[model samples]
Target: MQTVVTAERLWDGTSLHQHPLILIEDGKIDSIATHDSAPIPARAQVHDFPGATLGPAFFDVHIHGAAGHDFMEATPQALDTIGTFLASHGTSAYLATTVTASLDATLRALDGLANEMAKLPQPGRARPLGIHLEGPFLSHEKRGVQPAEHLLAPSIATFDRLLEAAHGHVRLMTLAPELPGAVELAAHATSRGVRVSVGHSNATAAETRAAIAAGAVSATHTFNAMRPLDHREPGILGTVLTTDTLFSELICDGIHTEPEIVRLWWRAKGSERAILVTDAMAAAGMPDGEYQLGGFPVQVKDGRATARGVLAGSVLTLDRALANFVRFTGATIDQGLRLLSTNPAAMTGLAHRAGTLAPGKSANLVAIDAAGNLVGSIVGGIQAS
Candidate 1:
């Protein structure tokens, strides 16, 4: 089937153009032309969005769950619930992120995530592109909400086991670079095609750089759980900020990072290296109350999610993240896609298929209001209300 969509504005991942025409066929974008130059067939199905801006769909590479369901539940229903919520928020795909837990429990979650990836994404749902392993090897000093008992030393054997359990669906992993054997483990994981990220660590600048040299390409939730930036020592946070090659994830919910700091981060990383992640747990989209994150209980009050006095996660949605990012950085909507769509897709090896609104790419896009609110979405060329 062929479909032609006309929008007031269109962002093709990098730049926004006025009055554009998009043609999708067989689940892929066939062509994108300006309104005046576009050839619209008489028999083609057409959908016009008058006041909405059409852009490449959002892609969250680091997310746990939403709508009262946690990905650790390891059930199709849990994924379905999360997927439905994400699609409605303009995300066409996401990584099913896991928290620190016992080996058995983590493996179980990995198995479930792999199984979910093997199946086709339901209509009007966000596709589960892969899994992000965010635990099992972290610094006790900066573990944040993750339980201390399950933290492990970096080991190739353990990583291999977890990788097997995920059935090669593990796209990214977060570990503390200061741990013993971390450099070797990072190299090993990178060799096998898994992107390694440094996070939840207390490593000094040198140690963090060593991990980056070992193929650690990113930092998770920069400046949140890791060592603080110091003038003399300049810990992991400093290394992350100054390193031009490393991508940094920022949770733009205002609670995890102050708006001023977010502005600074955006300035340093620019549009290319800065990535926005919610790090949101099951509390997202639900009212203020108690929620479960990775089998652990958490409290949500006044928009803050906490566990045992430590900040746990958030209740933020991608649409709001986009809005907050635009407001904080004074960036245009098209430039913001570098964080919300382009960087994540490129990091996870999905850039060839998804992430952009261009010919030969998946017809995954979003409809947003003038203020950057997601009003509708399209997944694999199928529109969602």
Candidate 2:
């Protein structure tokens, strides 16, 4: 059976073209055709979405947890709660990120997710791409809300143990390049199909470059706890901007980084080079108050959550981040894909499996109005409507 989905406008997200009719079969897109640009073949099931827009489903590679579920508490029920929360906001796939904790606690969470991953054939809740391990290898100077007592050196031996325990379900790992054995650990993790990101650091430019050279493909929460920009030394920001190979993630909550700085970053890196991530926590979509990230107590004041007054995480959603991007940057719809869909997917190596509404891509997508409101959503061809 085949399905031809027609929309008033379809931003392919992969390219600069906005097509009309998108043909899909099974779970993958078969082809995309312009509204008045192609002849409709017979027997093609037509689904019309008039006065709507279509783009690739949003991907959150830097999310910690949501809906009262933290990834460090990777239980089946918790993941399901988080997944359902994400789907309502137009994210089809995500990396369930864990926080820094005790070795026993971290391994226990990983072990829990491993069992759940094996049982997620139907995934009736939300979709999980892979696990994002945020710490266990981080810098104490810029640990933010991560449990510093649990932080450790990035050792290949310990990494292998964790990876095996994870059952190869780990997809993303964040490490401070300045940490001992960090470069070696990045290379090892990359070789095992884990996307490496440099974050929670105080690394210099040279150190950041070394990490990238060793296979850190992305930077987590750029311009956060890491090194600041220096005219003489240029620090991590200089290295990240200069290195075309490294993709970066931004928190975009109006608190993590200033809106003016957001615009500056957009101009410096461009949408295709920088990605927007929520960096959200359990308090997201919930009331502003005390919450937790990696077992550390966080207080949410004025929509910004912090641990001991240090910025812990955010209560921002992907939709809110998108809205913030436009409010801050004045970016047009053409520049939307890279931040919302394309860049994150490409950086995580999930581009082929998700992101973009092109032939053979998953049917995951969202339709937002001029107000940036997600009015319609589709996950694996199933409409959430």
Candidate 3:
């Protein structure tokens, strides 16, 4: 079946390319046409958004939980609940990120997620791109919400086991490059098609560069946890800025990184390289109070969440992150849209089908009102929850 969706404007993420209608066929873009030039064909449905702009469905590289559901729980039903909630907000896909916890709990969660990923059907709300392992190997001093006791150096055997158990569903791993065997572990993970991101570390500039040279392509939540950028010897941040290919993640929730710094990173890295991620937790779509991240107790207050008084995760939604980027950076909607959508997909190697609205690309798109509210979301040519 063919469908035509028309909007007041269109943003492919890379740029704002407004046309009268977008033609979707067989769950992929068939053509982008001007409504005035082409007559609507029979047997085709037309969806019109008179005053809204159509944009690529957002792709969140990092997110833990939302809407009274969390990924760390690792239940199929729980993930589906989260997926339904995310789709309503224009998220088409995301990595179910895990925080540091007991080895047993981590393993159980990983094992469960591996199974759930395999059982999921094709049609749904936002889908899981893969599992993102954010802990078990980190710097205790900067563990954030990760349990200190669970923080340890990488063990190839254990890491390999977990990855194998996931059966290639684990897409990214976060680690501190200064730890023993960290560089080697990152290299191996990258070799297996999983990206390595530097984070939760106090690694020096040299150490960070070494990790990047070893295939670490990103910094987890740039300007947080990891060493701050210094003038003489820029630390992890310096390494991110210096390496042209280095893509860094950002939490645009105003609290995590100030709007000014967010704008700076956007300017430096360009929208294509700075991926907007919701370092979100269970409290994201819930009210302020106690929640859980990877089985650890978390408390949210004043829109921020913490574990044991340390900044734990976040209570932010991806749509809100996009608004923050616009409000803080004063960037046009086009740039912010790319940072939250196409760019993140590119980093994860899923841009081929999921990112922009182009001929032959999967029809993952969202409609936004002038006020930045999410009006509607679509995934694979279907209306998402």
Angstrom error at residue 199, model 1: 0.5
Q: Rate the local accuracy (lDDT) of all candidates.
A: 0.88, 0.81, 0.82
Ten contiguous residues with the weakest lDDT in model 3: 117-126
Clashes of each: 0, 0, 0
Give each model a TM-score. 0.96, 0.91, 0.94
Over 4 Å off, model 3: 13-15, 42-45, 120-124
Task: Put down candidate 1 lDDT per residue, 114-197, tens digits, no spaces.
Answer: 998999767678888889999999999999999999999999999999999999989999989999999999999999999999
lDDT leaderboard ranking? 1, 3, 2
* Count of backbone collisions in candidate 3: 0
Ranking by TM-score: 1, 3, 2
211-324: candidate 3 lDDT, tens digit per residue: 988888888998888777889878777888767788989988888888778878887888668888988888878888898887778888899898788888788888888777
